[model samples]
Target: MNDSAAPVPIVPVILCGGSGTRLWPRSRKTRPKPFLPLVGESTLFEATLARCDAAAGFAPPVVVTGAAHLDLVEAQLNGCKGAGTIVEPEGKNTAAAIALAALRLPADAIMLVCPSDHYIADVDTFRETARKAADLAARGWLVTFGITPTGPETGFGYIRRGEAIGVASGWRVDRFVEKPDRARAQAFLDDGGYFWNGGLFAFRAGTFLEELAAHRPALAETVARAVRAGHAEGGRFHPDAQAFAAIQSESVDYAVMENTAKAAVVPASMGWSDIGNWQALHEALEKDGSGNSIAGRAELRDCSNVLVQSDGPRVSVIGASNLIVVVDGDEVLVCTPEGAQDVGKLSGASRQ
Candidate 1:
């Protein structure tokens, strides 16, 4: 479908709620990885704004984030060319979060929902894939981007592909597979019919709500109230928090996509990374001969395949291998790379 002939209004929804507990000390409740200047001078949020494809009818993205980060979210987007910002009263997960945006957008518009904290080095490929997804979405199909898995990654969920909808095109979601263990992940790599679930989705507004209402009525009803109550000004919506909180917390995957039959995955390689934890960050960052990555200000000696960051005085690491070290004002995090996923649990325990 020529986008010019029959244009699809694409609205970008940026989900920016995760605590970044795995990267704690630097990524905190008040400031998460999305807000932190990780990759460069610009925060991840700003990079996401820069990545929007306005020519493809993608309007300024609507950022779905917690109220606490409202100030940060607005600040990052303030100078951005084409981006909108909205805050949720609480973290109600993706289903309610997305519903709020869909309700506020034009009924005829299609949306491309993205997470704010991810890192994509190849912006061109990302934008191109998004445009393709938008084309599919315009055709009344709920489209999702499926990352071509490079290796056995236990960190991400997997999607099984079905009969093709086009040549190198739409694929029916065989099922939403859970994050597998190392053995299962390796098998998925060897089997060759699986792709990493990137979480990016494109679909029509009314169609999504229709499916949500039919499959997950409770969630649909609750989100509907919030979406209806939401007020939009220049494409930004301020939903009623009290009402939104009434909705149960759930991910879009669970509330709709998993249940709906129209779900399709657009298999593409966009160099995607959720950056959920330090290990993921380490994997995504550029590495040196010693296999060590340094962010902020740090010095490493005899380190291999390790990540270290310092926000204070010049830091030094010696004889550390496959570890993560982060130093912030009052917090210091050091852990083995394999155990980095447990950092969230450790941080939660420390709070107690």
Candidate 2:
């Protein structure tokens, strides 16, 4: 058992889908959350790229995004070099998206699958977590980063940690649990062995495809055929449209992680957030003394725990608490933090 810290480059597989409607008005179909500079000056996607760009231990990223957002994705590259883009004909969830990336890389290459829209404030801690996961990946364990839970967060799923795997800092995944109710979430926090499933994963390309094929044979076969027939256009690999459409859609958690025996987790405290809604985005952003987060031209008076964002026209909130107000182009949204989850559903109502 030799323990060594060798420099091994990990290929980043960025999943760039989702309309992010819960972040509505600002995160629209035309320009979704990843493309927008939501948190800081640079967009979340660009930040993700920067996180994985190291002198050693990280190769250029292989971004997996929809064909429709190809131009947007390319524009945001910001001079960052990449392995290439794997353009999906349509959204087929993460399982297939990851499979496309796994097929593109060398079998032994370690791939770090990250969602483009997530916000990680502490880049140093995140890189450390990636190194830990990579170590586990090199040892043939499929690794998922278990974010140290900040609170009883019901919005995210949880992973139960099992026994430590030999001398490695990683632990075997005892079980994968779905998002729970408030009481259950609190119980999980009290139990102390559970970590928030941040959806960040690391695995060798061959290991991931092997497990994916073992569980989803037809999907594996179809995606492989799609990859084999795929064509490259301007540094982007376009999977066979018809073939990709034929495969069933499923997330990596459902198709592989939940079922694989090699599932492992590396607990990390990286100040991470998926930014699934405006409330999440608000939490990730800097707040004033009054606990109010104001972005762009916004004025606030007697407000606490409030978030205001505007891209066109000025936004003003007075005598409000726990409210989210956003203005983007022709759309304006006003909702409580509790009501943020339903914003995605509102997009359809607006269309109707």
Give the best candidate by TM-score. Answer: 2
Candidate 2: regions farther than 4 A off: 1-7, 347-352
| Per-residue C-alpha lDDT of model 2 across residues 1-352, encoded as one tens digit per residue | 1245354678888999888778888877778889989999999898888898856468989999997788888888865665588899999999999999999888889899999999999999898889889888977889999999989999999999999998888899999999999999999999999999999999989999999999999999999999999898878899998898898999999999999999999999989999999899999999999899988798899999999888868988889999999888778889999999889889442452
Error (Å) of candidate 1 at residue 88 is 1.5
TM-score of each: 0.92, 0.96
**What stretches of model 1 exceed 4 Å from their correct place?**
1-5, 53-57, 232-236, 347-352
Scored by Cα lDDT, where does model 1 land? 0.81
Error of 2 at 139 (Å): 0.7
lDDT (Cα atoms) of all candidates against the true structure: 0.81, 0.89
